[model samples]
Target: WQLFTKPLPQPQSKSQNRQGGEQIVLLGLAAMAGALILAIYASGATALYNYSYKAGLMLLSLITLALLYWSLERLVRSPWGRILKAIREDEQVAKALGKNVFWYKLQALMLGGAIAGIAGAFYAWNLTTVYPSNFEPIITFNSWTIVVLGGAGNNAGTILGAIIFWAYNSITRFVLPTEIIKDASLGAFRIMSIGLILMVLMIWRPQGILGKKEELTLGQ
Candidate 1:
């Protein structure tokens, strides 16, 4: 929908608009085909009951992480990445410089969405099931925490942030006085601790552990 509306040139006539719509449809179909292929391959591999799913999952995850990291690193170091940074800092300035801000933004959104979809697919494979309840609003918040803790716009930082967040959760689960507090209350306390830690981090270093202060727009 964003591709159809935001990035493309405004069509002056009905025929031109139809053509644009057709392009989006074609792209969507291609994406779906790729997804189908991946699904089939994963299903076949995991279907073998004797096969170790954990080993396969771990190997696949490492490969995916490497590819994603390499791709993002290369992109961010290119000239196009400078434009993206400019757009993020000031869209109006990017527009004034004759850059297609809308198109760049749309591209960023599409890239992010695609990566997220891949991650979701992997998550489903790990769980061996896909259910509506699997997705919750807290998932988004947790992602935000990781991003903020790691340092915005820094891929390595984001990865480290996620590790730290999960490590904290694991530690708390085992270290907390579960006998004193009910299981439900303990869960709430764990969440509150994370929130408190985030608040402290925000106050001390709004740019995150690895982030440069100049790169942040906190005061602005």
Candidate 2:
């Protein structure tokens, strides 16, 4: 208990350790490389194989998502990633272990903001125009729903959750309108469905599909 309470010793050689800036730079470089490959493939695939433009764009988006997921997975497995987890679990614990918790939190925010920026840029490109109306308050709730359905700390689960969510959206858009609900109440029904699903999940499996019980931090 005393040892845990005491501040941990700092490393003697700071230069030997990987810095946050270096990690960010590497992530940026990886994104750039992935973008370059995507551009080359998009052009060649469309021109040579006669793939539809929309198909090519979809392929590019999938490739970009894969690259981002891979990069993030790598980062999460690194020592610095462990520290981030520690901070998430308990900032005071991380501070006691000699980590600059505030700095790590800032880095996390920066990384998240960058990823959101990339997604926004891709969305604008896909739609060919951006509208303030596109980003409704419901969008934030939907994101939270994805996280909850997928489980926090599980990247693959998040991806799967997204796929499921879109599938649900498709059904609501096409089938529900014709078969079940009136158009006026469809939006309310959709939100209600999501809420019910969340309630069921919370009751039966709060940790989510791919989440471990130990990794569950709902109340914490």
Candidate 3:
């Protein structure tokens, strides 16, 4: 008789993921730089630089959003997506069914990192600069808040939530009473309001406005 030992799988460390994310951001920045250089060579440097300012990145942003929304919709409806959902609901059950949960998780993390890289490129374009401070913990917290507000399982809800979040930011800047809430405290007040709203919603509608209760991972 022969005895065989199967090695236990090692879980991915957060530091590894953070390093991977940094690499993806660097790649995205490189690609954007390359495109800019090409554009400057083809068109005059002055012309290309002016175009970036006058052409308005809004059109590109909208087109990107549309394509992303369509792609995500298709992805969530696919078999692979179904497997991901299964894993999310219960990883042990997915593993029991012979599904490679680790592979699925790695794929998901890579895909998410790619998306973040693209977004980071857009952020640089919008601001015309990038710095270490730009990628802060607050950004991650805001992303989570958007996901919770929109409903985690539904992509459309996520988009809608982002729109609402930005709209609130735009409105409150002008509408908020500066007499009571000073300019310095206005931002904090808005965030607090959002938190209060989320608390109320969580107590009454934990699945979110658009998320199906059956698909809510909170129940799991």
The predictions' CA RMSDs to the true structure, in order, are 9.9, 9.8, 8.9
Error of 3 at 66 (Å): 1.1
Taking the tens digit of each residue's C-alpha lDDT, what string does model 2 give over 1-220?
4533554345354332323332342233333333333344444546766555545566666677778789888988999787876655555566778776556655766886686667666665555577999879886666666656776566766666665665686578666645466888888888999999999998998877776676654224
Candidate 3 residues lying further than 4 Å off, grouped into runs, are 1-54, 217-220
Candidate 3 or 1, higher TM-score = 1
Between candidates 1 and 2, name the one with more favorable TM-score: 1
Per-prediction TM-score to the true structure, in the order listed: 0.75, 0.74, 0.74
Q: For model 1, what is the error of residue 192's alpha carbon versus the real structure, in angstroms, after optimal superposition?
A: 0.5
Worst window of 10 by summed lDDT in candidate 3: 17-26
The most accurate candidate by TM-score is: 1
Q: Where does candidate 1 have its weakest 10-residue lDDT segment?
A: 17-26
Residue pairs whose backbone atoms clash in candidate 1: none
lDDT of 3 by residue, 92-120 (tens): 55678887766666566676667666666
Write the residue-wise lDDT of candidate 1 on 110-207 in tens digits.
Answer: 77667777777777776688899977887666777776787756776666676677668666776667777777787788889889989999999987
Model 1 residue runs over 4 Å out of place are 1-51, 174-177, 218-220
C-alpha RMSD between model 1 and the true structure: 9.9
Looking at model 2, residue 46 earns an lDDT score of 65
